[model samples]
Target chain A: MPKAELLDPQGQAVQSAMGRLGFSGVVSVRQGKRFEIEVEGQITEERRIELEHLAETLLANPVIENHTLTIE
Target chain B: MPKAELLDPQGQAVQSAMGRLGFSGVVSVRQGKRFEIEVEGQITEERRIELEHLAETLLANPVIENHTLTIE
Candidate 1:
C-alpha cells in the first residue's frame, strides 16, 4: 500500500471536506500533518498520476496543503 | 538559546493564550504545531526546570499539547 499524508494549514475546511467525503472520524488533522491515507498500488504510471490527481484535487488543498507519499 | 515548539491540539485556545501573553502572531498553530519559543541558556539545572515548568503550565495544553526543546 502507498501511504499518503496530507497536511492542511486550514483545518476546518479540510475537516469539512473529510466529513463530506464520509471520512470524518477516520481522518485526523492535527497541526499541519492532517490526513493520512493508505491506498493500493496501481498497475501503471497513468494510474499513479490519476491517484495523485485525486489526492490533490479531492483529498487536499492545492494552495495550502502539502503531501508526502510512502510506498510500503 | 533553547527553542521550544509547542503543539496545541485545540487551536483556538492556544491562539488565545498566545495573544493574552503577547505572543500573538508569532505563534502559528497550523494543524497541531503551534508556538515556537526561543529561550536563553540558564545558569543552572534549577533554571532549566523552571523554564520547563513555565512552558508546560502556561504555554501549552498539558492535556493535549506536545513540545520539543532544543538548546542551540
Candidate 2:
C-alpha cells in the first residue's frame, strides 16, 4: 500500500475531480501501482521468496513504496 | 487490474532487467495502478455501491482496466 498522505497531490486531484463529477465525501485517497506476474510453473515456497525479493529490489522503490504478492 | 498482456512492454522490460540482475523464471508480468481511498464515514451498503460506481466511472477506465475496493 502507498504511504498515507504521500500520494496527496495525485489523490487530492482525483478527489477534486470526482467531487465535481458528483462524487463527494471521499475524505482522502492514495494511489499506487500493482503488478501481476505469470511465472513458468507452480508458485512454490522458493519461488515466492524469489518473487518477494524481486518485488522489493526491482518492482518497488523501498524509500516510498511497498508491495505484496498474491496467487490467483 | 490492467488488461493482462496490455502491460507487456513495461512488464517485459522489467522481467528482462530482473533476469539480468540474476532473477529468472518470471515468464510474464502485468503492471497496474492501485488506489486506496479514505472515505469520510462508515462504509455502509449504499456507500459501497456509490464507491463501486465511482471506481468504475472515475477511478478506473473501463476500456482497458479493472479495479476493486476494500476496507482496511
Candidate 3:
C-alpha cells in the first residue's frame, strides 16, 4: 500500500475556525489531501520511487502543495 | 502536534484515472483530507481525545467520511 498526502502551505482558515470554536490552543493548521492506494503486486524499491514521482506529478500540485509517501 | 485525515469510503474515480494513465498496477485509490495542527502546549491524553472528537465533529463529515488522528 502507498499513502500520499498533499499538504497546504498555509491553513489560516481552519486555524481561525478552531480558535473561534474555543480551541484556542491550536496554534496552526495545514490542510491537505490524502490518497490511499493499493497496488497490484509487491512494492519493490523502484516501484516505491515511481509511486512518489506519480504522487508529485499527478496526485498533487507541486506549486501550491507538498507531498509525502508512506509504504505499508 | 496532531494530524487528522478524513477518508472516503469509495474511490472509483481516482482508480480509473490511474488505470487510464498507464499505471495499471494501481488497484485502488481512496481520496481524503489531511489536517496538521500545531497546539499551544503539551498534548495530554485528555487533549488528544478532545482533538479526536473535534476531528470527527468539525473536521470530517461522519455520514460520508471517516477520520483518524495521529499525535506526533
Candidate 4:
C-alpha cells in the first residue's frame, strides 16, 4: 500500500468520479498493488521470512509503499 | 486481477528477477490492483452490492481484470 502521508492521485480521481456518479457513500479511497505468487513447495518459516525480505526489497518500494506478504 | 488467460508481463518480470536472486521456490506470479476505500456507513448488503458495482465499473477494467470487493 502507499504510504499514508503520500498523496494518491489515482485514488483521488476515483473518489471524484464516484461523487459525480452519485456514489456519495464512499468517503475516501487509496489504491495499492497486490501480487499473487505461486511457490514450488510449502511455505516454511524460513521461506516465509525470505519472501518477506523479497517483498520489502524487490516488490515494494520502501520509500513510498508499505507492503504485507500473505502465503495461503 | 488480470484474466487467467492473459499474459502478465509485470508478473513475469518479477518471477524472472526472483530466479536471478535465487528464490527458486517461486513458480509463478500474478499481479493485481487493490483499492482500499473508506465508506461513510456500515457495509449493509445493499451497500456491498453498490460497491461491487462501482468496483466492476470504475475501479477495474472488466475486459482485462477481475476484481473482488471486501469491506472491513
Question: What's the i-RMS of each model?
Answer: 19.2, 1.4, 4.1, 0.9
Error of 1 at A41 (Å): 12
| lDDT by residue (tens digit), candidate 3, A1-72 | 112243334467777777777777877687777888889889999888878878888888787677889999
Candidate 4 local lDDT, B1-72, one digit each (tens) = 999999999999999999999799777899999999999868889878888898899999999998887667
**Candidate 4 or 2, higher TM-score:** 4
Candidate 2 per-residue lDDT over residues A13-67, each given as its tens digit:
8889878988678887777788877778788898788888888988888888777
TM-score of 2: 0.83
Candidate 1 lDDT, tens digit per residue, B1-72? 012254434444434544565332322333333332323444367655654664475444676656554333
Q: Please tell me which predicted candidate would have the highest DockQ against the true structure.
A: 4
TM-score, cand. 3 vs. native: 0.82
Categorize the docking of model 2: medium
Provide per-model DockQ scores: 0.04, 0.75, 0.53, 0.88
Error of 1 at B59 (Å): 1.2
- lDDT at position A28, candidate 1: 37
Error of 2 at B13 (Å): 1.4
Off by over 4 Å in 3: A1-10, B1-10
Candidate 1 lDDT by residue in tens digits, A43-65:
36665565466446544567655
Q: Which prediction has more favorable DockQ, 2 or 4?
A: 4
Judged by DockQ cut-offs, the docking class of candidate 4 is high
